[model samples]
Target: MSKTAELLKGAAEGFPDEVVTQATVRHLDLPGGAGRFALITLDNGFDHTKPTTFGPQSLTNLDAAIDQVAAEAEAGEIVGVGLTGKPFIFAVGADLKGVEVLKRREDALTIGIGGHEVFKRLSALPVPTFAYYNGAAMGGGVEVGLHCTYRTVSRSIAAFALPEVFLGLVPGWGGCTLLPNLIGADRAVTVIIENALNQNRMLSGPKVYELGIADAIFEAADFLEQSLVWTSAVLRGEIEVVRQDPDRGEAWDQAVARGRAIADEKVHGAAPAAYRALDIISQVRNGDLREGFAAEDQALADLIMGDELRSGLYAFNLVQRRAKRPVGAPDKSLARKVSKVGIVGAGLMASQLALLFVRRLEVPVVLTDIDQERVDKGVGWVHEQIDMQLLKGRINQDKANRLKAAVTGSLDKAEAFSDADFVIEAVFEEMGVKQQVFAELEAVVPEHAILATNTSSLSVTEMASKLKHPERVVGFHFFNPVAVLPLLEIVRAEQTDDASLATAFSVAKSLKKSAVLVKDAPAFVVNRILTRFMGAVLGAIDEGTPVEVADRALAPLGLPMSPVVLLDLVGPAVAHHVAGTLHKAFPDRFGTSENLGRVVEAGKRTLYVYDSGTPELDPEVAALFKVGDTVLTEEQVRARALEAIAEEIGLMLDEGVVAEAQDIDLCLITGAGWPFHLGGITPYLDREGISERVVGRRFLPVGTAGVPE
Candidate 1:
């Protein structure tokens, strides 16, 4: 294929670099004029047979390659493209390594916008384009399909939707436009918004089509042959053009109507975005696509470029990019296999992490705390879960016992860490205590242990400072209830060796966690940014603003829970601890206030009259805000909360506590109860420019430092 005259060879132009081909589709006119198309393949420039990415030329080469094919094909044609491999992926999506090129702005073209633009150009092609997706189609790779006239999926494809909205932008390309146009608005919005929320909601071919995005599906075994048959049909003009239902997707329209009614009835005095998206869909339903596409395009473009999108996209990207796998001794092949894992603490976090690790990796694990009492409690938890699974018939007793046996509790650290290839210490969030445990483990365990600490707000490097084997200390910062939270920060201290980092990545993979590599800075990634989020809520309280108002104001902004409720779940002590850590590490920037300390001293939990696990904004909370009787109606309170949250998010980015604008959204979505339909906090701010407007009306002016007392 590479030797083809104007086909694959010419596709390499402009790319000038080595490329990864993730998609391949070829069309042919048979002897009797029977058009034929065959397997689309995906292949990397590098041999993962060895541990490396594409050769120096990079993924840009593949983009250049595909661009060439699109150029040759007429408008809307599923441009013919192929890779070295067959029947899997024709080409993988954007080479994230391209981010390296993006960082040095003056050195090369801006990566994100440039890649976005490329996808848009592909979308303009007029012929019926079909991507026979075999494997994964992520980021840029999926963007290409947005341009295509059609999409077919092989059962092998682990379909997903993403725009890195949590990374500080929406799908900057036309994806935001194309998706809503392809699917109906509600489903597309759900896909994009949920991608920002969890990042792990896997959508398959039938699912994608059910969501109204995909065009067809084929068998994985015969996917190569089927893809070609479909492509040949395109060449022969036998397939129907992709078209929307005349009712403009009424099924989706009805769902939206039903959802809106539910939202209004159950979640009163809530923000309107979720309902608004449905409204927008309903409005667009009566119109032709031209009107709908234009509206969605401009709205999405403006939204992605907004504060919420920027903050959210940045934060999400940051969280996902850090895959700190433990590849010790540099042998590469068998770096961080994490065959068996050991948990040092079986408290809630420890138990949570244990369940998640087992759920993710299906690997055997040993969970231990200081005493049999706590151990029994933790083991009891596993038993309860296993029993539930047994009752649910999700697993039989034999399997239940196997899984139950897979998780055991103990008081012996030496025994736990000995056979275990990796260990994570999720003890209390104290540096000295973590160090003491590591020291003890080092004395009793094997020399090649990969020690991980699940301290959210502590410094990874500082934690390593007290260790004899400093290189082994890595921060495996997991959010509360590790079983539930998806993001894992792999904090890399200055002393952290590549081997240790690789081990963390290995463990993360075994545990099926999204491991992001972060510098050993204050709060690592998620908490550093989240600390600012909590502070914003507190800041609103300090400015004589009512807590009830602050809480309700953000309700409509699409957060899962209000800021106060989130704080209670986080535990005021832990929240304060992380705040103090970030403040101490980067004083002036992450500085804390008497307000936070006062909360701790005054014995105030996040909200008043806590309603057990999930906090409800009760009367006591209203009293805390001085809302006498009905001073401010629920509607008024929610409006103010939105304003206060926007202000503090702005402060975080300005203060540099959050390195990327999207980091705010990532933290909010994962840790801070961010609502998916509302896309995350930063996106809301950006879409409305509410940040700018809020500051103008209520907040201190942009350049001004503090709010008026």
Candidate 2:
């Protein structure tokens, strides 16, 4: 046995639930009578839902299959070797369940080296190797193809990516070395760094071919047969494949520099994975694949043994598992079918909701406003958005027509909502206005219909307080730009029944959103936490701190946007309103910013101007601030902000705002776009000792989001 195989002998000891992927080999005659071929199919025994992953046992299986093919090639029995996956899934990557059980650096190093040793044999074989990416391929799946001499991808494959950096690890299994050598450094940086940081953006099949990663692309229906024929043609000298020489000059240095800038902007140097991958890619300009492989192995081991990777893995599990099966949600069987929907208020928010509902539920939706002009504008906006989708090829013409026709607008509430099963109001944030809307909606809609409110900060319980059928009222709060953000805070009022809440969850699932169950508190979960955080920065600015210093205080935490940018995105008026609401509820912890109110009063939508391609504080907005004599440094600002957050989270936990800390983290991650490296703030607080110092305890136990004690 090889050193790698020996090292991995007992690596699967603790992974009991790992679904071991198997590699089976078969012999097939070349389509054009070129020669015999050795074809290997990767399967995990389950359906496509259970994608093939590389674990210790799975890697061992593949290693054995490679040995068989290598021997056949040496014996001149097979002219070429081919690798493919089962059904709709090519492979996702390593089994994270296996990675989670690794306890020592040696084990982590062993896994990385074992993968390199096994996959390297494909390129070393005497016969030419081919990879048939028949379906979704990611991480190690993509790396395996990079080891082959040629690759063919199916046009129908939905996702392809090297997402290791996003998960707090480098693409260590020959990816960082082989990909840049195959496709040059610039494209490698895009697939390895830029795309990974952009929420792990995926590449289409055509994109893979366009990037020079694949030699050819074929339709999914007969992808295997066509790939076999193409391979036969290549072997018979009937088809010639040529590749452009990789650029190893100044362009390589420029690409690596761009990758560093992206990593700094995205993670603010808080995570080390992106920099590590960049280093490996930069060293590839010397054309020593072995040196690059060694760098990858060391980097992988270091990251695997660090807290950031563990925290990232924890966050990944939370998003993949907990977000799907939300805690405290009512039974799915209790949900009522929403056949017809009604939306109150004909504004931007309501129009977005109309489009989302009509597209996801495929049900007739009506929007009502007090004036015909507003109603016509709202309906026209929805139609325009549908046309845009059609133009982008996201939806067929028939589907776009159906969606546009399904959404209608009317001036009469009764005509719009008399038979509707679900009616959500996107009216003013005032409690009285929302209560009046719900009261009117209850009188018009069916008795079994649900009355939902999209109020961001108003009390859901108070909104339903004036309704006769309070049991049918629930809070269905969606983040801004409804089509983009995935979070939907499903708030349960004091009088909300199980049926209403269950139906809300069902609708959120249909919208492909991550729903977190929150109580009807002052500002719910995300807005409340964010208000406290932003309030700290604003308070610093009020005390004479520079706007630039206050805004960049939390740079070390790697938040998606700076505080000032976030304030601009959330709108000064909206932030002022929410802050006022929170201050009223908890005056000591949540402060109302006078400067923010001034900005809103001045009708300023943003605090910054960007005519120079970079954000600069707007002079008019800056001149409006009323400051005190005392100023705070950036560290002081960041500390105060985090301390305030820890305190507010403790209070929220005491008040049962959500079930636990994980729910708060989930809310911030999906709703506010917080970085995963911090595990949504609580873990960062715990690791930094802020949670214990401010909250008198840690939010999570040791080893949950930190190093094991």
Candidate 3:
């Protein structure tokens, strides 16, 4: 047996039951006696929910299929070859689950080379090759199409991307090499690097066609038939496909440098995949396919064996598996149906809530405020947002009209919430104000109606304690920019009954959010840990740590946003309130900062502002801070902040605020924008030894976060 086959066989033995995307070959008769074409369909026998992925076994199968097509071409039995995917899905990329079984660098290198070997044959085939992308094609999947001679994409294709860089791995299987050669180096950098870093944004079918990635785009109703006809015509010399030659000039080098700078600013060079990807794109034009494949193999092997890749896999699994099945959530079957939703205090947050509810639930959402003017303004805001969606082509005019009509506003709470099955109050954070709102709501709301509060840090139990129907009230906390953030903390008060808790979770699901069942505690989950971490940073600043120094200290942690950056995004006033609440709850662990209050009072949106495109300390805000002689290094700042997080997470676990450490990790990942490459906060805490020092043990089992078993 060949050495590559031997390595693949060894790898395959370790992943026996991994889902293999089998390649099925069939003959397609060309129109008007043009010729016979061999069509290969890539399917995993799963629905659209399970996207096609290539593992060692799947790659081996595909290699055999390619061999068969090549043999048929040599024998003059087929004129051309075609490759496509199942309905509504081309392929997602490599099977990340298969990476979990690889324990050696040699195995990783072997698998990477094996994929390149199989895909390279597509381009080297004796006959023309075409890729019919019926739906989403991503990562390795996109690479597969690039290997084909001509490509046809369905207009219904929802996603297409090279997202390996986002998951701590570069496009290893011929992607780094072939992409730049097909598309210009500058455009390649945008697709493979910039888009991946920008939350994995994908290209639409029209965008792909516009970029010269696809030769033809057909409607979904006749996508397959039209693609087949187009392929036949191209094979018969009836149509021409032209591509612009890539430029390998100074502009290419400049584009690559720009991508590197973005990576540096975004991750502070903590993630190696981004750098490796830029390196590959920079050198793509310098080498042949063989050399490029070898480079990618080396990069993949090294990354596969790195702790960052393992951490990424852990995080991916946590999101793919654990987040979907919430740890402490009660039976979903007990959830009640919500036909109507009511929002109190129709301000920005409340208007956002009404928009989300009406659009997602397709139900009536009524907003009530203190007076007619406020209510009218809030309702008008919702309408304007819907109109913006219509203008952006996100929704049709009819859908926009329907959404606008579903959202109504009134000055009277009793009239607005009388028929609301689920009513949520986004009122003042004060206990008295929330309690009064709930009391009044309970008086008019139906007996079965559920009352929820959108408080970030207030005590849900205290607010419900004053109400006669306390059992019906639940804490439904949503982060700022409610439409974008995915987390919905469903806080269960002591008096909250199963029905109300289940309904709150149900409403969260209906709104397409990840719901974490949290106990009613001060600053429930994300805000609690965030408050503690920011408090430590603020304390260090008060003691003489420079603002930039403190902010840059956590750069190595690879958080999505920095401390001061987050503080700016989340208004300092809100942060101050949450800090005070946490200090009131756990005085020893959390300290209320007088500097925070002063900054809020001064109306400073951020401690730092942009000066000529560079971040500098705002002179007015800097004057408010009392810088001292004693200074801490970046290491000291990071340690102080992490220690605070560890201590607070320990207290939260001890108080049963969340069921386990993973929930806290999930909350931070989803709500606070923690970098997934760090495998959430707890694992990073464990890796830094702070979890052991402060919490006495690791948050997860030793090996769960890439530590040796």
Candidate 4:
């Protein structure tokens, strides 16, 4: 009935870019035994078409608002409090940038500013509070939900977790302790730690409740009403509280004992942290819950803020947000859908994409190659997915049969792509090979069909130049494990038309993967940045930094994997090929390292001999680089590496390989393992003011630095 309540209602209705300050206030109706509750929402309401999480100040303010509701409820002025948001979502998480931006400011971990205090305050509120997780509840969002006594969720595609560890921070609030208490210690630790490394590992509502993390799940039809109704039950004590804590102490000791034994049987050894995290949980399983939580919090906090977590979190978050913009697309209203797609090669990349098209769009997909066996093998892979999905209960037998019937395999271009609405060729990297494939595909497919080439490093425009319908050809570069990696780089070229561009986005969207548009240039954007980083790593070894030491130094920088290991994963041959390609494109920028080529040509695994376990300060590498037994300092290696990478990123930005500074960061996060805590190039520049100095020197040779924009 208050003016603030009226304003709150209006805010809850939703407005773009407006932050919601307060959602609810509850008050008693005279002696009638009824109460009125005030509820509202805060959102940017961006056209992104999904619920956005809290972005800084929002979560800090939200904690205060909850306190006011709790005060009013405890004063006996209101019988209940409520929360509401539409189209399925409760707060999924706090604004990620808010937490990350701390590094930019001195002492970002200042007491109240720590933000975890908000979660603790929410959990300690006296009056019963319930969370309505209408949709995906992410890091901070899930932490806040777990703070409430009773949690309800709509039967929607929503998940819950304390995933902060993935972003270089732990579930600072009591989530680390509360989750284990609510669920079993073993399950909670395993789930928490995995998410600590990767945010996408999901723990959903129905399962969370079954594991005792959430209190209830509701059908979407009346989710909010049901949540309100549940709160009343909790307040009246109709629902009994259950506490399940199995002794984790001895159990953890036994686990470590088991892990040590298992380590002997395994290649990677006992996964020390895996056993340790669970062991600590067992140590305090039945102890004073909050006290145990505080202890656990310190333990997790110590590991969470380390260089490893920081680097990993930065890259992980960066990838999720930045790596997903379309490199090019037609205006939404003019977008076209491809009814049939063509794959020019029956190789792994093409075949993987072929399977996704059939599984995702349910459209006709054809695979063609030089031989029947190769084509059949590609088609067989799709069929294998058909049988697997049928067994997984994701699709019924009937749908699987339909999917199987929709795919085609052939050696003849006319039969494979004659009716293709879009044609994507994944062939040998040679220009002649790509041109020949496109020339034939252009003849076989209709003029309206979009011509797409899966070329990682070649010029898209040149490939299209050989085709009569050059306007239809574009680059569609997908990362390996097409089903897993969520990025699809759509390379825009000079000749690609509006219709074709629109079709590319349509295809990417249908595949449920994020699209990033990049111009067709040497190594494109992602590889350009990676080339610099990997080049620096190899260079450091030659410069006497020691190979493993240089590689390990970059690891704390938060790459997805070690640099040398990445070379192995990419295959020595391909690394050499890509490096050679870039080196040819820009001699100074991509200059080859003789030491790197040595390993590539010979296929040598171990680069340098170092102490046991640690890969740093290798004496053998010193011998190769002409250094004595004196150890190579980590600082020299790291600084040189950072300078080199910063320069390459600057070149891409200067050349407009990607149009924006953020796009450069996205490429690193998504394609390479650029850490996101730096926010992007701009933020990194802001963080390391000397980054400009580094960029200035690196770009000097490429005619980029000191040149007028």
* Candidate achieving the largest lDDT: 2
Q: What is the TM-score ranking, best to worst?
A: 2, 3, 4, 1
- TM per candidate comes to 0.60, 0.98, 0.97, 0.76
| Regions more than 4 Å wrong, model 2 | 13-17
1-709 in candidate 4: lDDT tens per residue?
Answer: 3333333333223223434333333343312323455343434454435655653345445655776776766777565554544455566564443333232212233321234555555556665556667766666567666766667666654456666544444554555556666665556665566544453467656666676666777777777667666666666667676666654666645543543333222212212333334445555566455665565456444543343344344555446554444544568666676888888888888889888999999988889999999988999988998899899777998999999999889888997787889888888888898888888877778768888887878889988887777888878888776787666778889988877888888788888877777888887877676777778777666665656576666544444567777776676567777888888888886777776566555655555443586444334433444433434566766676677777767777778787665556665555553433333334444345445587653222221111112
Best-matching candidate per TM-score: 2
Kindly list the per-residue Cα lDDT of model 1 for residues 1-709, writing each as its tens digit: 2222233233233233534443334445432254332223445545533111221233344455555566556543333442324434444344433322221222122233344444444445543445656665554456556766667677556645554443333343345545666766566656654543343366766676566566667777887567666666666678765666533556756655664654443224343323434444555555443454454444444443233333343343445542233212233444556767788888877887777776666778888887899988887887787789889766788878777788887788877778776788888878789878888777766678788888877777777787688988888887766666666667777888888877777666666665555666677555655566566556556555566666665555445556676677787777888888877766664556465566676677655564585445555444444212324544555455455556655655555544544444555555544544344455455455567686544222331111111
Predicted candidate 2 versus true structure: per-residue lDDT over 296-337, tens digit per residue: 999988998887888888888888889999999999999999
Every model: Cα RMSD to truth? 9.6, 1.3, 1.6, 7.5
- lDDT for model 1 comes to 0.57
Residue pairs in steric clash, candidate 3? none
Worst ten-residue run, lDDT, model 4?
700-709
lDDT of 3 by residue, 1-709 (tens): 5454565677776554777899999997987576999999999998777889988778777787888899999999999999999988898888887786577788788888888878888999999999999988998899888889999998877799998887888999988888888877778888888888776788999888887788899999999899989888888888888888887888789889988988887678888998998888887776477788888999999998877787778877776687777777777788888999999988999999988898899999999988989999999999999999999998999999899999999888888889889999998788899888888999999999999999999988899897888998899999878887788899999999888888887778788888889999899999988888888888888888888998888898877778988888888888888888878878888897777788999988777788869777788888888766778999999998999889888888999999998888888777776766787888788877889998898888877767344
Worst 10 residues of 3 by lDDT: 1-10
User: Any idea what lDDT model 4 has?
Assistant: 0.62
Tell how far residue 180 is off in model 3, in angstroms. Answer: 1.4
- Model 3 global lDDT (CA atoms, 0 to 1): 0.85
